[model samples]
Target: MPEPPPLTNHGKTMTSVFSLLGRNENDLTAALGWTLRSSPKFLAALTGALSPAPQARTTRIDLEVSDQLGRTDLELHGADHAIVIEAKRGWLLPTVTQLETYASRCGSAPIAHLVTLSDCSPDWAQMHLPAIVGEVKVTHLPWSVVGERLASARRTSAGHERLWLDQLDIYLKEALRVVEVNNAEAYCVVISNDRPGGGGPHTYREIVEQGYYYYPYGWGRGWPAIPPNFLAFRWEGYVQRVHRVLDYEVIPSLQDRWPDIPVLSESSGDRARSDVTDRPHVLCRLGPALRMDPLPTGINYRANRLWVLLDQLYTAPTLQAAQRESQVLRGDAVADESASI
Candidate 1:
């Protein structure tokens, strides 16, 4: 667990809860430059990507070296190579003319990289820039890719540098909605039915009609860790069939407004607790559902938890697959509906 920050920096309420990236785009870029300058391995990786080169030596590493002409966001200069970076945050896309302006001023630099949080590359960025900029090979980087690099660097960093990199990593993870899972790549998660034989809140029929699903996180059960971006729904005691998969976001019930999702009350002998929302509930915007035909036999009901790996479940290519599976499951559920007339 993270230690609570000093509540008051000299008898005042702490205003900037987040560090560099949270403040603004300029700060994020500047921080990146600072981090790269401190780490020789990262600096070499950035330079090598632009063009072929030998191993970069830390002795020659230079950050923000004399960009008086272009005023680029960052400049990593070395003895025989250099890279000029124009960093962007959020949806701010650089135009062809703007890139051209920067490239022109780079003065025969080995690489001119236009990095942004998203893919804002129009045709001209890829097709026209290389020809116009001459020797400067142009490239685009999404925050996701950059976040991967930061994560790698963090592992080898030390002391204050590692702390700063960790802060930047936090910002990237939040913005990118990527989760670190099972010592593997940062990926999404899937929710498994607590009861292996099905019969749970938000059934297949319900999920198909609703377009979204919500499950309270950490409800004192052995729930698996939730991923950063998406969620998948799986039925236990069955052949790895994924009924639905959707991109999801976490909503803090205490601090943030609840999502406007349909609430259905389906409890036995009591008023349903639909309206009493919980904090850190995952709301998955429903997507494709897949079914496993000819259900495998000899399956055992084990865990009473819902955390599942997203890739392990099977996803159907079409709604027909979901419909076909739902019909079968719904029939079984109806037969088991003891309250029916």
Candidate 2:
């Protein structure tokens, strides 16, 4: 097997106070609270992202408020509006009960909203979290979106505010595992395709012919938070072909994004495809398919998907070798390798 490429830092590097303070959920909540308290413009931008428009004025910002129901991560009270924010470190989804309890506190305000900030995508939240708990409207704002809003607000800011925004942006990306920008150190996702034992709408022929691959978009689904730069098709007990990801789209259905492609479902059994066909999917348009040496399947591989460093995928002789190389690159121990993927 050929040697793997050397790992190098690709994106902008910056120092963040949050990074020094042990970046966790509490730190994230505190940083967000501070940002809101320090900058009214940022607060307005955040409020605008939520439904029912921006609040007139933010009267108070509180962190880690404990009550009979549960401890709310952060709370923002404004004239006629109350916004409760629950911050999770990574892709952790907020429980319905926890959200409902937070919603209970918002009853006093004329306009109430519950927002959840996490690395999980909006589509995942929509599929998992309830839209409304009682009267208060529920919204899941991905940290990526929050970072974008803050960056936008920072462009017009100056001095300490702009500096803080820059730090916060870096912190959010590093700490919260927000959408990863494509770079030289990009990875490839190896996806399972339909076969005799595996049942799905996407057969090997369909994917090769269509010039695209898709994964169901939701929490616990195999889709990556950010689309990988490359995709490897794992079928027939080996990785048959690899393709560069030209572009991607998240859509409710195949026809919704590509009207020409017929909506397809499994021909046998329960027709499981029907259950997911109407739901959101991440469709990745591919560049020319590149056939590779058949990388043999390995035991302990992830059920439907696995992540491999692009260089490793190209050079490693076996699936397990690629996974091991990726694990080393990610600094994950043998036991924790699967968990990280």
Candidate 3:
């Protein structure tokens, strides 16, 4: 029997095995466990990130280990420390009971830690999960952070180590939707009216005609750290227009920023009671709307604010198609000309 070809070799001809295997929680856990077991440097980096103090050397990597409480997704048994991991798909988090149960399995190791890996943000996870379950310290690690750390580790690695880390990083971003906006070559922000159907000053029509868009500062609303090259407006279940970002400014109020425009002044009056008119806002000035087909929004699309690659948004037939195409272009799957969107 011949030895199987390396994972890197398969990238040119077929979709990544990691991407295919990562479709479900169990499979994803197995894939991650395999990576940690195969790559010593990656494992060390992960453990170091998980622990404040240096972790004891990992001696074993176990998957779906059975116990009285439940089966843990993955476990790293170190010489003096033990780490129990519960992997969840999508934005799901492990139940409190599940976390406590897994924490119990950590035993008498000097450093016992319980970690949950999912698409949910770390802050969100921290709010939901207990800081500590018995003697075991608990924490949430977002897949996005894992992907970023892998990319960072890969930068200094060589040979097979670098290749494996590269594939896993791509798998996390492409298949799991653990994307980092900063990594994109060129991306656009898609914004929608706070109240889509309700008559308002910031209506899609008003924004298009006025050639500007503004979002209130802070409170989970703001622009990306990396300024987007384009701004897209979504309304009536479609992305109606995309505009090149001409310029932007942080202003105390809409009136302060563009008092000369009567429509904007009227908008300021409408928002007076809400205090939004007086609050600081990121006022983004934009170029004329691009002439293109309106991309129909998908049923699963829920975000009022989201980011999409500029090229993908322009080239894809639908909003969903744009997202899928972006994943493929990022190396999540093999690009097939005949493949249906």
Candidate 4:
């Protein structure tokens, strides 16, 4: 991976700090947040759409299909998605060289679409993208439309995207075990910089003091099964309550617990708006945090699909087939082979 672009400018302007917020992450949450209640196609494709967003916190594959002649922009592992973007930017446009490199990296993954934020020839994107991404639906929105400028890859002081894959593999193992709609562990959001009210983390600690999350008694996605004994954070003027506060030991940083990244509060100018909240905030008390601004209600987080699947599977009359299928499906039997059945 190429080194991350240095924060350009003499480090002036809110753009240096707030520009990340403006970067078009291709985030489904944010995109839908902007487009939903209007575009039904986007609404239907919400989950997958957001999956490719930069800050999903979901770790993915990395490949930069460089030309035999030269290396260019990076290509994250992207297949089985509906869109592919050849938005090959920076010093490598106006030719098939960059596109070929990216397409090479695309090896074997089903291509659904391609989009390019770069000012490549329309003929190039329109004609070549489908072939390059192979079946991924292709659309090249201008960088102005996609909202990405200033290109480069993530880097650490160690240089390069220096994450330990071995650690990530273990993290995924633990995450898979707890990612189900049922039996999910609680998530913690940091408040290190907040000017807390009486509620905040103290409320969560109080809930923990009362044993709210004790041994499978709690639920996520909605309000805490127990109330009045919960904690709430005060932002602006709204009081956002915790569903189940926990003393968790997530192997990765606490940031990974929530399925999404927290967007910045337009009202507050903090470096980050808030933590990716564990469960959606319960409206146990509402006056303290910003009220007019509502929170998201996502059923995917420990509320919707998996438990329903389990309930029906467990109750099916043909117990043998369901059990066998469950074993194959859940026991790490090959995903492709298992899906065929």
Candidate 5:
């Protein structure tokens, strides 16, 4: 249990809530970046083709194959130079025998691997592998930190905190598991939170100006000043409308009208479309002291929206608008921030 926040404002995480705990590596891996679904073929292809660069730039190969017996749990294609993976959140540790079986079939020169949602000590795995597969690598990914980060973001953003929470619940309860093996160095890369002209007049414009990857709905890379991904709008509802054209500003009126409105989710879709479903939307803004203070109840309210309100909205206009407002001026707000709307 975390202690109540200190009045002195150190702004540190309440260490009690983050003490030593058992972990699942696969979940964390998926939470950090990708979610592998569909078939073993898809997981393998995603790993085989994922680009090492910050900007993704590669066409992935498909490694699904069928055997005379039935659908092969894993597949590899020789010409494509790819590997396939099959997942079972059930096992304590995944085995190399699984990898060798796929390698033997594909006859590809590239190294093949196995991924699992659960894991054991590497020593336990070494104890079980047979000669034919002993050398084949088996990557055991745990979902601990990745899940925690995604969950925390969902529960804390100002814009769509509720929706993000909902989306997060879906992720937690689902049968989903992913394996993100990279030839490139892998890290959970969140952009530097300090962006100029961040929090805008209509949204969390001020905080976004500083460096804090956060916002109402979990949009964009959220630099605390503004949203991470785009200007605040989702397909189902107006994200930042004043409380009531009849009365309040978009943020407050939205709450007055529909207290049940959902928060946002920070996750994205395969197409990289900005309008991913269940991303957050606004409910209401909070007082300044509450807004900046870590572990504030309202912070969770906003974080909920980022991922929950991942619905698609028109991207072109919003992108255009964000650019016009933030470019080339030493604004009371950040310059070059207009490109973000």
Candidate 6:
């Protein structure tokens, strides 16, 4: 038999955090168990989400409850449900039949769910999940949805309990990085001033401040076939930062004022107002401003630049790192100012 690769330090840390055997104990399955046992607020949230009857508390929280099939991550007994959760930190999605086995083992419990850090589940799981496995109603929840529920629970919690819940939120947001920024259908538009009439950074900043995104009516076919929550990047000659994360309403024609238009005229040295108005234009509402720097080196600036594909913008590594740094910087600044005072 071949030896499996040793767990990395980070993996070990995750195991320690999630395991049922106290903080020093290393177990990958501890997190759900600990939260359910220790955090009353979280338990309440979980149970409420799982069932209508709120679980005030649980009598038992069993970790790695096994059946003929496999071990479940955490099993909460003596609550509103014989709730079984399979928590996964990485992208490894659960098989539908595997979940069905856990659900079957849950027995008379009306609610069972699989919680994972992945943004989505597999196609087969998606199609087959929520189906009854024995009497248990199976549910699939992503970490972000779970985090929001926990956050709601945190408000009602207090002291150390609240502190623990807060820690869970931080863990979900930072350690897990499970909070998805874009919808599954959302896409990227890595556009720059590719033509004589295309806008620049000054125009990009104006669009950002004004809270509207504009494209010339004659730019392309009727509204770039993209879903809402699409990202728009501004390539400022040197670097590309996210100009806007956007959701749009089509203006149909330049004359339609459903979404307010920018002041322009035939005198702007672009297309004639009358000439442009004949074509449909997109009146997009700008979303959150993001700051990401130094995208994948040597991007193609010509040919297909209008719909330049940069899927990594959804992850936006630099922006997230910058945001974290800003939080720390703000805290330090506050401390310095307080000391000076």
The C-alpha TM-scores of every prediction are 0.44, 0.67, 0.55, 0.24, 0.27, 0.46
Q: Pick the lDDT winner.
A: 2
The candidate that achieves the highest TM-score relative to the unseen native structure: 2
lDDT: worst 10-residue window of model 3: 332-341
**Model 4, range 1-341, lDDT digits (tens) per residue?**
99666665446332222233332222222222333223323323322333333323212322233456554232333334323244333212334444444444445554333445443335434644453333233445543232221111112112221222222222222322223334322221212233222123434334333333221112233323332222322222222233423222211222232223242222434432223233223322212221223222221121111111232232334322333455555564433212211
What ranges in model 5 sit over 4 Å off?
1-58, 61-64, 69-81, 92-98, 119-123, 130-135, 143-169, 173-341
- Each model's lDDT comes to 0.45, 0.72, 0.68, 0.31, 0.32, 0.51
Where is model 6 more than 4 Å wrong at Cα?
1-29, 52-57, 89-93, 110-118, 121-130, 178-341
Instruction: Give the clash count for model 3.
Output: 0
Predictions: Cα RMSD each: 17.5, 7.6, 11.1, 23.7, 20.9, 15.5
On TM-score, who's better, 4 or 6?
6
Clash-forming residue pairs, model 1: 192-306, 290-316
Off by over 4 Å in 3: 1-13, 19-22, 178-341
Q: What is the lDDT of residue 293 in candidate 1?
A: 52
lDDT of 4: 0.31
Q: 1-341 in candidate 2: lDDT tens per residue?
A: 99655433344333576565557799888888888787777888888897786547989899999987889999988778888999986556789988888888786787788999987779868978988998788999988788888978998998878777877787777775433545423334444444312443555457655787766666334457556777777665677777777866566665575454444444545755523455566777888877678778664455446667767766888777877887787898755445543
Total clashes for model 2: 0
User: Per-residue lDDT tens digits of candidate 6, residues 143-170?
Assistant: 5567778888888889878766765565
The worst-scoring run of ten residues by lDDT in candidate 4 lies at 148-157
Q: Please give the distance, in angstroms, between residue 101's alpha carbon in candidate 1 and its true position after superposition.
A: 1.4
Error of model 6, residue 82, in angstroms? 1.0
